[model samples]
Target: MGDRNGCSTPGGGGSALSVMAGAVIGAAGLAWWLLSEAERRRQQPRQPRSLRLSTLRTPVPAEVGTGTSSEPHERDLHDRVHELNQAIDDVRRQLESMNTQA
Candidate 1:
């Protein structure tokens, strides 16, 4: 079968035209959406310099150390050191046991 305008294939011309039109419409829609989004972002309210400076000038509260001890920082450090010593002892015992077995 042949198409009008003396073409050999059927429906080829109409399909190609439809594809081109769809692509053009899709491109136009994407461009419009991007431009609108950019315009909206440009129109948004920016943070005032005075508000930003004030926030920067405010003093932050002192951070409290973790743990329930009276001297939290010293107690935390002591506990950590004790834990490390215990771990060292455990490793030494393991090494001794391995040497005896060998």
Candidate 2:
């Protein structure tokens, strides 16, 4: 009942429809991947930034009993502290660069 391509002969009681469907889907996926590769290759490479810093924010201290167990609040505090540390490091680097240049 099956042809060489594994598709059933017409009215031969096999999975001709499924075989054709699979072929169509495979072709579409291949075409998509090729197009994506071409587009990516066409884009120019990017240069790294000389300096980067996150925006400064005045941190509000956690309230004594506002539930320190809240996950989002803890995450926010952690992120804020990290940004502050990064800013401090940037300032130190700038100072060192200035001293070296002078």
What is the TM-score of each predicted model, taking all chains together? 0.38, 0.33
Per-residue lDDT, model 2, residue 41, is 71
lDDT of 1 by residue, 1-102 (tens): 455555767577788889999999999999999999998777654446667788889875566676333476788899999999999999999999999999
Query: Best candidate per lDDT, number?
Result: 1
For candidate 2, give the lDDT of residue 3: 85
lDDT per residue as tens, model 2, 1-102: 348654455654446668888999999999999999888776523212222221134355565675654667789999999999999999999999999999
Residue pairs with backbone overlap in model 1: none
Once all C-alphas are superposed, what RMSD does model 2 give against the true structure?
Answer: 19.2
Q: Kindly report which residue stretches of model 2 are placed more than 4 angstroms away from their true locations once superposed.
A: 1-14, 46-79, 83-102
The weakest ten consecutive residues by lDDT in model 1 span 61-70
lDDT of each: 0.82, 0.73
